[model samples]
Target: MDKNLIALIKILVKKSYITRTDLEVETNCSKRQITYRLEKINDLVEAKKLPPIEYGNQKEIIIKTETKNFLIEILRKSYNDKFYYFDKRERIIYLYIMLFMNLEYLSLQHFMSSLKVSRSTILNDLKDLKQELAKENIKISNSRSKGYYISGPELDIRGYMMKLVLLSLEDDHNSVVFDSIIDDYHLESFQFSKKTITELANKYKIHFVGDRLDEFIYIFIFLKARLKNHKNLTEEYLGKPNLDIISEMKEYKFTGELLSYYKDTTGFSEQEFHYITAWILAVSVGNFAEETEDKPIISEIVDRIMIRFEVLSGTHYNEGPEIFKQLYSHIRPAYYRLLFRLPIYNPLYPKIKEEYSELFLLVKETMKPLEGLFDGEIPEEEIAYLTMHFASIYSKKRDYEEVVKKNALVVCSNGIGLSAILYNELKEMFTDLNFYLPIDAVKFKDFDKPVDIIFTTEYQLHLIEQNIPIIKINPIINPRERYEIIRQVYTLLDLSVFKQPSLESIMEIIWKYATISNPTQLYSELLSFFSSSFKLKNEKKEKGYRLIDLISEDCMNLGIDAKDWEEAIRISGNSLVRKNKVTQDYVEKVVENLSPYFVITPLVALPHTRPEFGALSYSIGITVLNRPVEFGNNEKPVKYIFFLSSLDNKKHLPAMSDLLHLLNQKSFFEMLDGTKDKKAVLEYIRCYTSQSTISSSTME
Candidate 1:
């Protein structure tokens, strides 16, 4: 008995006996070959004292499914060996003929058309097919008068094609070649699902070799079509946070309001969003979880989704229709969240249409028309304030609470020295606190003031009231204890926004380090100027006014140094002076993209740069405004200038905080508008800087 005969019998049993036509379609074996193989199979079974495979009245072959599966399993193992000898193309052609056996009325023209070949080619291929079949004891009964037919015992071929498809996926070269051929023509001319199988193979990165490429391509295409229509889908909660992949953000108790808010802000549909936004929020803290290190988990999840999709479609993995649908459903939403949270903006919003509405609206506001100029989206990414606005907003939400901060006033017996120390320390401990200190010592009756709390030592009790929230401590307080007192005051006042700085004295240390040039001259002159010129403006005494307006005139004078400074002091931004300083590390990247300092707008240029570049001088250059100039984008202008020149980024850190304190004053910008003389500008800065309510952008 021939090997082909044995193979046919095995396929029949393996598939529980498929139709003869279906067998040929799957195996590409000719009817003549199938018949010959069946004859040999019968002889072999009789010789072995085994029952022969049967054929039903319907003319379908019969084989035990279990036995066929076992044969296929063995054949698969053999296919792996390079030395395994079989003519794969010849096998397919042979099976094709067998599956359509005994159709004598189907002439040579019909056969040629069905096979998608020329008459001569078909004749020649048929000759080879017949010869192969003869070897297996099968015969094609044909005459010039009768055309052609086949006679044989049953032969099953479903298992043969199933095995072929599996083999094709295992060896990728075959699938690639098959895909190329199948894509060129519609195979209804050949009657097969070309795309379905090919798509599945591609998704799995499966490759094929030899002649099976066309079949694989057909399978893949079919799978793709089905995927597009959402014909098959299933879902499961895989769990929160696929730590294996950085792209997979951890799952949160996602609220619809949050989703709706996000949609309103970004314009992406809820179904299109992912948890990556949340992931970014987590990563910004600069620490990562141990589980996040695993990469294989991502690949595994992708695989599971792929396989599950196939199961739902009731098709072989590669041959299932709807492969693309599955792919989109499984990965795109997660990708959206990841990119939204990542450094790159590509892939998340590949186009303007994809951008969120809030982001777009914010950009529009930042680019609002100047007093005399029209506003529009600038093509330059750097010029845009979209990133800055969101960063600031995000920072506030993460670091500050919305609750109103508590106000505290510190009175001391040592006058300016103790008051300054307490004020600085408390501000460092509670950024949200509104702290104040009197310029001179006063009796307790004179110090009868309105304040949420009061902090003073035993010696200063003569100047402070016991009825107030008095936090009594040593005159020379521990820095840590002082911070705790501020914190306690904040708690008592129910201030949510009063978050302490990451480190106490951070700004102070930075200022000291940066103010290295002529510290004595700078400090002495600055202090003397403050004491003699500007008298304190009481916020409580000012009627129908914001706290900022009360101190604005004097604060502006101090900020704008006029008589001594040679050059006009302009705007100030972040900077870095020391290369080796760990504290100054944050300023490094900011300066890389932007001009270290920008002083290039009209009369109103903010003469400051990014802090990464060290400052050349350690001095404040103030220019008294003879006239106001629109300094910031046209909407915000400058009247008096306090040009900051730090030796390095670290030194200017204090001024940054100080500026924040000033800018956050509800009327700080408006107050600058009211300054009339150079003296007023200097007076305002000195008076405002001394007191705790630094109403600047930095403080906020």
Candidate 2:
């Protein structure tokens, strides 16, 4: 159980080989001590029924990877052994929990023995702990009788302890330090309280979003274990809600149910319900469990906050009342945290501050709503959490549409599992065009799919003739590859192809060379000139999509074999061109603009071009594919192509709405997907369109 032997086992577990001399050089163990401890390690591994540590013939320390790890966990968990890895922060936390428990006399030797660190390490930790606690005006007094003791107001001490635990929970690597608290104290009380809270939470349909509930429970148990020393929320350093206000809320009743069982053992007073209620409300999100209307005061604050945020961030919530509802839901918990002086740790605080520095500062400036409501300045951590809500609002205002888009094909080796995962990651990153399911690498050469870029895991793909850009990538792409893959895909695309003549560039050519006094008028005329296509595109969208009005019965083609999305577009548009509703130029224009965005709600393409592009009349062409064609621009493959030729935008909005309604019907898609008869598809659209448009109030 020597720390040195544990350290040696840790080394052996990490490395493939370590010689007797290497072990001595790495560790303080002597040659003889190394010989003896190897026997000890073998005995431990054998006792666990694992393969014994082997000293290889050439003097390498040969240990089974499993056996060495087993010994390390044993030393890690064993109460008798204090051989574990933790940082200075973790050490201070472990020490704080110890002193907070007030379990025994905790001297320097006791600290050294418990933490398995040296005396100097414990001394420095206590120094840092003191400095940290002093900010809250809390003191860690040490006496000869009691080695270390934490003294502060009950609420501050409890909050500080919980804040420490919450900060620890924010870390992904500090589970060892987190788990130590369970081993160190209150095993049964912690378990019982967790089970109780969990059962009640589930029964009430309450939920926790992330690690908030876990941290909340640990802090609760710590406070509950020391109930003999502390009473309910009587600390008057900060203001809390009056009795009538607390009793009026739904949490009061829920608190009664939660604390009724603990009343006898933990001796909960009347005020304790308010204290426990604040804790419960801070973490719970699901169903906002037992949510009632916010108090009038809090409601007004939420309103003011929303308006103030809109002004501060220069963003408008024009969508609906949904954003307001969400803002209130999030701010309710935030209000409780601020009002009760409850500190939370936003794990995203650093990233938010770094990435959203301007938004963070703006949100901080917009905290006037909570100004008179709370006594103290809101914690920066809380502000970061609040900033996220506003940042989402602000981000939604920007048009994130990618100007230059390309079709990316994912080709992976062997099984579809890894390839499927890679496909999803790419889908999330490139939202404008999430590729269809991944294809096999072997098919990459003969693949007739429409692809602008090929992403393959196989290295041999580079040697092949991928007339399209082929990016050879690893099966499991790391962060650098993820970034580089995106960069490479964008680099492969020729942006000039997508870039039209902008007003500014045109003006630069005109104004830079020729001076004009009527610049504003010239700018307007040039903007109108440049926007002719935009006007046509917008105008073309307003056609009434009644059954026979737009969906020409002569145009519906079912189950035709198409090579690619381009071919699919042409087949649908051919009927419209032949009917003189569109020109061949119109068909080609539709092909040029054939993006995945034209794809229907599910597996269909509805490609259209402007009236300026030879849309001679309003008509529709429908073609169904025997096989789905991957557009390389959407999650779904195109099964049916609907070519629309519009001569005007007038009344097109309602028609587009009707079209969306038709597209959403599952039976319509099913009929088209299966029916060989073109009449069946046209008849279904006819019946639905008649039923829908006949109900229009404007008809009255």
Candidate 3:
């Protein structure tokens, strides 16, 4: 059997069914040669006693699975340059088969039509493909109803490509184009006209030759552009071939010998030969297509191809090499027809053989299409924009906060009192400036906004449950430590700064705030000092206990309800007032990546915030639960909640040490869980305060 015939069969088997017409278009050969080749194919098949791969009913001829493996082995040998060198068509045919091995059913007539060829040419090639299959005991059959497909045991197809397809070009091509002859392969090709070409040449103020000079260069440019963008150009039929003859252009010259050499080297048909030679002339001169308008599109193509390949797939000159070749194969003829109308460059400079050679190699590498090759079809401008966008994203290392900033809303009560102060503070702090009101003057319904942060001095119980950052402060006559509050807000929002502080400084602050030894423990007491509700009437008349009575009476006077009080307790008691309280190991685990807190005191735990986080209020929430829960100190589980808070670089040492002394009592903790009365809790606190040694120490 003819080795080429065998190679063709393998291609068909792997590909399932490739139309004979495709072969004709690809080989640039006639129907007679293909048919004669097929008759020779059957004799070889008989000599080997292999089952016939060709079986045609009424509709079409098909290549089957059994024959496919045999053919692939032949391709493997050819691909390795072990046997004869294959032509461009054969190479494309083999690559297509190897690349899309799972292709089963194929429409023979439709495939032939796509190749723009006659039925006889297709039949002859199918004959050759089948004969080769027969030699390998593979069967190729066609049914009037079911069309074409392979049938047999599974074969290790992909493994074959991994071994053969990925083999180095040095091992196969040997740095020469015609060293391999792949006649059996069928690849799509197209062309353009001279009139369009000269138009482009005139517009660009370059030389335009009616000969093979300018045509070759134009094709090269088009191929390079299309390949980079991963775009396919279908032939646009414009009634007649738009041919323009530029008689004045004596700038570039070409010899018949050069044309003959090209024709002999690259197996181009008569028309294609003319087109290729003309394109080469265009390329010879420096009139390559360099449209600024096309740059964005080309760059976009490069970016997209890179992302798809997960590598730098193309260069800036054009999309890349692979796209060029595919275009060369399919659109060369269409290009010829459009050439007359195509605006071209003049005096096709001497062709740069080296440049073309480099381009050819790149095309070969890029031809192996993968899944993500063309998934994102971005506009040229958008792709250019994305370059800057992706750069910013990477430079800033923005994970999710950037998104929140663009969408979040900030709020503070009517821009006057503490709420206003907090509002301006946050507005200056957060880079993405957004906020809302904290006053009852605006209805709760009116407060509906995409709020992410809400800072308020006066607690409006109705607004507590709203979706936003609710930074509540004690209602005060005059808000001190406004700067401190602003700084804390900045840290919380992770504000963008003119000059970013060192990572050490940031981490130090974070660790100090997240740790149990900081001043966040005093939030409530700090709030109490600033709050002006102590002189209220109705609630103090009932409670008897001075502080609680005063607060309750003020709330009743303000028309707040019991439900509001319960909510206040939940929000203030456990959530806000309790500092970096490590209630459990899990809570400690959550903050472990940021800071190491609980190791300061063995039996005592002081929960607090770092001084940098503006502690506007010094408050404490003592939750002496019914049962003592295990805390950092294994020797004595925590019963006291010392909610500490502080201003920058200033820790209230005496108050902290006083609270620590109370917690140092064994009996106080022993009966801590037993007490249920509110009065009893207060009485315990009073007793603790009466003790001596009220100073703080920094010595660990």
Model 1: lowest-lDDT 10 consecutive positions = 538-547
lDDT of each: 0.37, 0.62, 0.34
- Candidates 2 and 3 compared: the better one by lDDT is 2
Candidate 3 or 1, higher TM-score: 1
Sort every candidate by TM-score, greatest first. 2, 1, 3
TM-score for each candidate, following the candidate numbering: 0.21, 0.48, 0.17
Clashing pairs in 2: 539-649, 542-652, 543-652
Candidate 3 whole-model C-alpha lDDT, 0 to 1: 0.34
State the lDDT of candidate 1 residue by residue for 1-700, as single tens digits: 2335445644553332245544554568766666666666556455655556665211446544343344444344443433333343633443333333223354677665554556777677667766755654445566676676543421212112223443444332133323322332332322243343344335533333222344333332332232233322222112334323433433221222223321123443222223323322322211112233332443343344334321211112332234333332223332322323211111112221122222322233232222112122232231122222222222211234345356677654322323443455454455555665533333445555567876653222122224355564433233334443544564557666555442223434545568556533543444344322222232121111122222222223333332311122312222112222212222333223222122222233324332334444433333445445443333334444544443332223334434434544656555556555645555566677567542222111
Candidate 1 Cα deviation (angstroms), residue 184: 56
Candidate 1 Cα misplacement greater than 4 A, ranges: 1-605, 609-616, 624-640, 666-672, 675-677, 693-700
Worst 10 residues of 2 by lDDT: 534-543
Which should have the higher TM-score, number 1 or number 2? 2
Of 2 and 3, the candidate ranking higher by TM-score: 2
Candidate 3: which stretches are off by over 4 Å?
1-7, 19-22, 55-58, 79-700
Higher-lDDT candidate of 1 and 3: 1
lDDT of 2 by residue, 488-563 (tens): 4544565332234434445656755798897557755654554443221222322233535677667777879988
Candidate 1 lDDT:
0.37
